[model samples]
Target: MDYDSVRTVDTAVADALIGERERQEETLAMIASENHVSEAVLEAQGSVLTNKYAEGYPGERYYAGCAYADEIEQLAIDRATELWGAEHVNVQPHSGTQANQAVYHAMLDPGDKILSLELTHGGHLSHGHPANFTGQMYTVEQYEVDPETGRIDYDGLAELAESFGPDIIVSGYSAYPRAVDWERIQAAADAVDAYHLADIAHITGLVAAGVHPSPVGIADFVTGSTHKTIRAGRGGIVMCDAEYADEIDQAVFPGGQGGPLMHNVAGKAVGFKEALTPEFEAYAQAVVDNAETLGETLVDHGLSLVSGGTDTHLVLVDLRDSHPDLSGGDAEDALTEAGIILNGNTVPGETRSPFDPSGIRAGTAGLTTRGFDGAAMEEVGDLIYRVVDNHDDEAVIEEVGERVLELCADHPLYAE
Candidate 1:
C-alpha cells in the first residue's frame, strides 16, 4: 500500500506524522519486539468500532446496540482459533502483560509459587520482576540460561522445578535466542502438578508459519502479543482449552480490565486473516533467515552472539569480547547516530544494570517487512561494526546514516 500518499485530514498532526513515516522509511528498524503492520490493519484499527463501548463478550455484552460489534468480535475469535488451532481464544487483553495477569488471576492465588525465566537472562518483567504486580502477588522462582552455552539448561530447570514446586511454570522469553523445548518444560511443570503457560509474544507468527514449534497443543495456556511477528495491532491475546474459557474471560473482564478495545480487535481480525495467507508464511520464514544471516555476519565481524546464534527472528549480540570497554547503552547511542534502531539488552549473568547492559537485541521482523534480505543484513552488520569502531567520529556516523537512508530508499517499507 502507498502509506506515504495516505493523507491525514488534520494538517498540524499531518506534518509530524509524515515526518515520522519518512524517518521509518530512512532507517533500519531492528528492535526485536517491533514490526510494521499493513495498511489494512491500520484501517481496521481506525474504524468506527472505536466509538463503541462493548463491555463484554459477544452475546453477553453489557452495552446495547452491539449487534455489529458481536459479529466483528466473533469473526476475530474464529480467525484466531483457525490460525493457531486453539480450542478457545480471548481477543480482549490490552497487552501481553494483561494476558499473563489474567491467567494468574484465574488460575493462581496470591502468594502462590511461580517458576519463570529470570528477567536479566531473557524473561520479561511481567513474568516476575520484583517491582511488578506478579512479583508482589506471587513467589517467583527464576531459572537462568547456561552461562557456558548461552542456552536454557533444561536439566537445571527441571531440578529447580522439583525443588521449588511452583504453582505455575511459565515458558517464554524477551531476549533468549534459541528455541525452547516445550515438551521438556511441560514435563517439568507436570512433574510438580503445576499449571503450564507459554508466552509466545515474540514468536507467534513464526509458530503460525511453522517456522517455530507451536505450544498451543501442549500448553494449558498460551499468551501472546499481536504486534511483534504477528504484524498486527498493539494488543494481546490468550488461548487455552475450552474448559477454562469462562474463567479466562472473567479474569480479563471483571478481574483485571473493563471494556475491551473493539478497534484494536478489529485490527487483529485483519492481521489474523493476513497471517493465514501464503505470503505471510513466506514472510515469516524470511524473517528467520534474515536473523540467522545477520547473526552470522555479526560473528564474522568478531562479535560473540548469545546462544551462539538465533533459531528465530532475533539475535542478541554479546559485546563482551568485541568491545570490552563499550557498554550496551554506548552501542545503542552510537548505532542510533548511524540511523540503525535497536535496543540494548542484558546478556545472561551480566553484572551491569539493565540500563547499561552487556548486550544489544536486534531482529529481522521489521527489516524483512521493509523488504531487506540477507545481503542488506550483511551491510547492516558492517554498519554496526563501523559505528561501534568509530564511536566518536561524527563524520563517519553521518556517512553511515546516509548509506542507511540509501538502503531504505532501495527497499521502501510502504510504496508511494
Candidate 2:
C-alpha cells in the first residue's frame, strides 16, 4: 500500500520520483486524453494480479491459478458492457491503438479501404496515420473538417464515401471539441456499405455518464481508453454487437495481443463502477462546463478557437490571430514553463508542421476531477494568456508558476 516505499529505491531516484509527483500535483494537466485515476484504481493496478498470465478468456486460460484473474476480467467485461449497453465487451487490448488494430484485424483484409478523419483535423494516428500499421496495410481515404467552420464536413465525407466505397469508416478524434452526429455518420457508412467504427477515446467517460451522446448502439464497433475521463488505469477496451464477439475475441487474443493485463482490468472494473455512480455523472458534466468556460475565456482574451467553441471536455485554440509570431510548440513550451501542461495541436488546414503546430489543445478533465470550477478556469485562462503573450519573460513565467502551485495547493488533486 506504500507507493513511496515500493517506488523509492536509491535516494537520488527517489528524490526525482518524488519531484515528478510533486510536479503533477502542482501543475494542471490539460491533456484531453489524460486523467488522474482514483486511489482505488491505482491500488488495483499495482496489485498482485500483475503476476498472472491469463493468456485467454476465462475458463480457457493458458496458465494455471487464474481463477481470480478470470473473475476480475469477467467483472471488467460485464461492467463495460453494462456501462455502454454493448452486447459484447473485450477488455484485453493494451491500448486504444491496439483495440483499433484488433478490430481491423478481425474485420478487414490486407489492402482494404478505410475512411477516417484526417490526422491534422483531430484524428488519432491509429485511425490511419501513414506511418502507422493501419495506414501501411490498408488503403486509407481521409475525410477532413470544414475549413471555414472547423467542423466535420459531413457532406465531403459522404462524397468521399461514395467515390471511394471504403470497407470501413472511422468516426472519432483525439482533439475534436464538437459532438459528432452519429446518425449522419452511420447513414453515410450504411449508404456505402462500410462498417461503422467509433473510437470515442476522448469522450468515453462523458458518453458513459450521459453528458455526451453514446455511440455504442449506433456504431458497429466502439473503442476507447479506460484512463481518459474514465479515470481508470492505462488500458484500452473494445465493444461491439454480439454478432462480432467471436471474431473480435480471437483477433484480440491470438491475433493482436498475448495475455491480458488482469491488474489493469481490475482497475477498469473499479473505474466502470465509479462511472455508474451519480457523482461520476456530476464530474462528467463539470468537465463539459469547465471546458466551455475555459473556451469562452480564451475567446474573450482574443484567441481563436476551432469550431468557435466546444461541446466537450477539450478545446483547440487557434493562435493565428492572437500570437501570429508564436507557434503551438512555442505556446506549449511557455505554458509548461508556467506550470500549466497542455499540448500543441495542428488546426485543420494548418500550414505548419505537426511538431510546431498553429494551435494548442487544452482539456478540463483533470482540472475538473481535481474540483476546479469556472472561477478557477478564468484564472487559469489569464495565466495561459500571460504565458503565450510573454513567452520570453522568465520573470513572468516564474511568477505564474508560483501562482499555479498556489492554486494547486488550494485544490489538491489527492488528499494527503
Question: How high is each candidate's TM-score?
Answer: 0.97, 0.98
Q: How accurate is candidate 2 locally (lDDT)?
A: 0.92
- Candidate 1 shows a clash count of 0
**Residue 196 lDDT, candidate 2, scale 0-100:** 94
Residues 362-416, model 1: lDDT tens digits: 9999999988888988899889888887878999999999999899889888767
Model 1 TM-score relative to the real fold = 0.97
Residue-wise lDDT of candidate 2 within 1-416, one digit each (tens)?
A: 22477455566766776677788898999988889889899889989998888999998999899999988888888888778899999999999999999999999999999999999999999999999999899999899999999899999999999999999999989978999999899999999999999999888899999989998999999999999988877889999999999999999999998988888899998889888899999999999999999999989889999999999999999998888889999999999989999999999989899999999999999999888999999899888988888899999999999999999999887766
User: Which residues of candidate 2, in runs, are more than 4 Å off?
Assistant: 1-4, 7-13
RMSD of 1: 2.0
Give the CA lDDT, 0 to 100, for residue 280 in model 1. Answer: 95
Q: Which residue pairs come into collision in candidate 2?
A: none
Identify the candidate with maximal TM-score. Answer: 2
Model 1 segments more than 4 A misplaced: 1-12
RMSD for all candidates, in order, please: 2.0, 1.3
